[model samples]
Target: MLFGASDSYSADEKMQITVAFTRFGKNLVQRMPRVRFGFVHVVNNDYRHWIMSAIGGSSHPTIISHGNRFRAPRNIAAKEVCKREYATEQEWKNWDWRSEGDLMLNGAIFTQSGDPKAAKKFGGYRMIAYKPAHMVPLLVRWSGTLECRPNKPC
Candidate 1:
């Protein structure tokens, strides 16, 4: 909920987007839920990120952002912990997304953003090290480069 930029999106706005995206994410999980996802670093070109959210004792869905890359472990699975894109929105109430693929996730490596005394939080996670298990960049700077676009065809 702490915004560093004036024109930057707010927590409430982000939450509304989350609510709508959750449906698509929930549906994605219901269709194919429960998988180990990998993590990565955020660069300028990488687009899209997902979280294998630990909610309701099951892996729920939470949209991360576009243009971020996660580092994957060698033995990761692709068909689990991904998202689906709904409709694109221009208002503060609409959330749109589509599935990139299953994330080979490792949630233990990333720290949650709400921890006390942290100066900055990105994409619901905090930055504790230079090489994080997951990476969340501020913005997307490339197109047609699916470096971190949720799902990679393998």
Candidate 2:
């Protein structure tokens, strides 16, 4: 995938995604997935780096972040884990964005909004099972770049 989110899309083309057991390491645009449109469920994972925020979004996307470990970057200003792109307070105030069971570290914060009943409604839906935050290191310890023995078949 490219470093940034781009392209034109229609309402029907929106996606519903589940991000689980993923190792989100150094990258740009907050070093994590930037939700554009549709439903997204981000489950247990290791977040190690970011420039702006961890999980960004726009266009009134419904996002549910749960059980993820967010180790924010050293920059104090970049501690927030959720960033809304090009939207005003009144605009994004009602979008369905919620974070539960997430472990925020180093001042990381996730601003949730909309649908208090969302949890009461969607909380029972366990489409993807994830372990507790402490197990993330063991689950993704071997992830990231694979050193293919320089100049080898890699």
Number of the top-ranking candidate, with TM-score as the measure: 2
Model 1 alpha-carbon miss at residue 134, Å:
14
In candidate 2, which residue pairs get closer than 3 Å at backbone N, Cα or C atoms, i.e. clash?
Answer: none
Q: How far is candidate 2 from the true structure (C-alpha RMSD, Å)?
A: 3.7
Query: Model 1: per-residue lDDT, tens digit, 1-154?
Result: 1111222223323321221112122222222222112112122222122334221111112323232233322223332233222312232112121222222333312222212322223434432122221332322222223455456662
Across 87-148, the per-residue lDDT of candidate 2 in tens digits comes to 89898989899887888888888888998556544555644665778788788887767668
List TM-score per model, in order: 0.20, 0.80
Q: Report the C-alpha displacement of residue 62, candidate 2, in angstroms.
A: 0.8
Best by lDDT: 2
Off by over 4 Å in 1: 1-14, 17-64, 78-96, 99-154
lDDT per model, in order?
Answer: 0.25, 0.75
